[model samples]
Target: MATKYAMLARTSRLQSVASTEELEEATTELQNFTVAAGTLIKVASEQSAPTDDLQVFVYDPVLREPNTTRKYQCAQDSLLPVSDDLWPFIVSIPEPNRRLQLVQDSSRCNWLYTAMPGDVVSVPARYFDRDDFRLFECIICYIGPVPEIHPVGYFFGLELLDDVQSPQTADISFTRKYFECDADAAIFITADRILPTPLPQDEEIESANEAPESSWSLTNFIQNTVDSIRASLPL
Candidate 1:
């Protein structure tokens, strides 16, 4: 009977994945679904036809390919509130193919993001000091959300362009590929641990000319991010 609700739709299990084909199959069971844990849904206050269930959409920036919406039905009791410091940051990422740097957040949270191929990035020595690695720069040659590594985030497949070597390939979780590079030169990282690398001066000038000034300045960026996350919620 509730009207508007904001919730994170999640699987009770460690993972729940279904092939789009399997999902389309009439006989596919409810246990076989693609709604992984931590997916976000906002109720628009509309009751679905016949079943009288509340209609909603399950979306995870980490799971959806190319970013699409999946409509779902659920009882009012099934929903839960959304609260997290990282989701707002995830929603604010700029376009794919931008340069980035990976870091290990002291907060113990790595990030989950939907990255496309051809993005350039780097990792600093400070991040991996405990490990033998010193430093490296890399380009994101491939990206995929499926074969979910963890419901927490999207992993990357990096092709290292620096002196640091790797022992992984372009794969994730082994069962699937997190952003993998080559077995000879690969390392996987989550979004929370990554930061964008700034573009060069010449390219920055060209980008400025290509687009009008945006409101992403120091003061405005925080304001805009807050506004965007607030507007996105159904609360």
Candidate 2:
């Protein structure tokens, strides 16, 4: 059996996206951002879900660094031997959310997992007003061998597309072509957001006192605030 893994974003965006139109709009905006940034590999909608609650998948080809060996092992134990033959990438929202939930129960929180070096996942889409769009940097920390036995840990980073540029369409076979190519290519994530594990202890202390770098950290901030509130409530 594939060794199961779970991811928790130390920081992310968790909004109550209850409306289908809103979700669709968000999907369009996400796709536009991908094309504008030139990170799009493949995108498609979940055929089984309701149209309003449509879930889109986006795949970006990412480069794997040598340092991620251990982290990759934790998520995929047997794949290392065949790693060279398969593409290294990360899937965007909804699918990861679903995959994670398949193994464990988490609240209804929408998020995109950071692209890890050796992980393979399904990919999301769509347009929106400038004010409705914002760039977010997410640091996803992985911990597992779930149900928490023999755990290993590390961090993966992803930056949500922020800018508005003209959208470009790829041929339907784009994803297949990408997988066939043997070149070492990757869709780039923001260099500043890629935080590796074993963070300095002092950095951890300083992070508590300092403000987050961007509004993207609002998800983390909100989650922390809610936890604090719950802790303070009468037992």
Candidate 3:
């Protein structure tokens, strides 16, 4: 079975989410849940371009918010592999509140991950959210290939919350911590696209203080985070 982990973010805005109550009820009905996983995960933006934008596509299956959909629209020219030539390059605003907020409130959080295939080694996270889209306003750096940029993780399943009288449900997916690439900025990565991998091995992990020039991979990040979560669980 695939291992599980808990994602904890400090967000007053997220605390009031509508899915929390529904997820509790749905978990009870599920005899076994094959937590969200797959290859359709990746963040996109239309406000700027694939190279530059102010929105992130975070595909969490348990997500139910509907208001942030408009801001996270994908650009017409952007595509699956994220062609740098076809993508636009817009300048980012020097503001933290705007950038961080973009990540805090996104409807596409479920689409930001994928299953593990060893071919591609690294990716960068870009695209911003509508709430305060200033966090991701610079270059998107990847951890694997030298010039290629990608995202933090990949998501697989998705289910919209339904109005069931017996048990409520939480249509949510999965996610990971991302690093931004701006020298002048505080954040290192943004939610750009999901990598086609689940968890990473112990050797592939990287800490927050690690140097930027090293080769980075989503598997390493996922494995490290999952390990932390597993350790915290009660017996």
CA RMSD of each candidate after superposition: 17.5, 24.4, 26.0
Q: Report the Cα lDDT for candidate 2.
A: 0.27
What global local distance difference test value does model 1 have? 0.49
Report the error of model 1 at residue 157, Å.
Answer: 1.3
Choose 2 or 3, whichever is better by lDDT.
3
Tens-place lDDT digits, model 2, residues 77-176: 1111111111122222223333233223211121123334433321021122344343232223221111111122121222223232212222122222
lDDT of 3 by residue, 1-235 (tens): 0111111122211111223455677543322212121211134333353343323333343321123432232222221332222111100212223323323434322323321222222222223334532221122223221111222222111111122111111211111222321222222222333223333555356554465766678977899899999999998
Q: How accurate locally is residue 19 in candidate 2, as Cα lDDT from 0 to 100? A: 43
As for lDDT, the candidate ahead, 1 or 3, is: 1
Ranking by lDDT: 1, 3, 2
Question: Model 2: which ten-residue window has the lowest total lDDT?
Answer: 69-78
lDDT of each: 0.49, 0.27, 0.28
Off by over 4 Å in 2: 1-63, 68-87, 91-130, 133-235
Model 1 has a clash total of 23
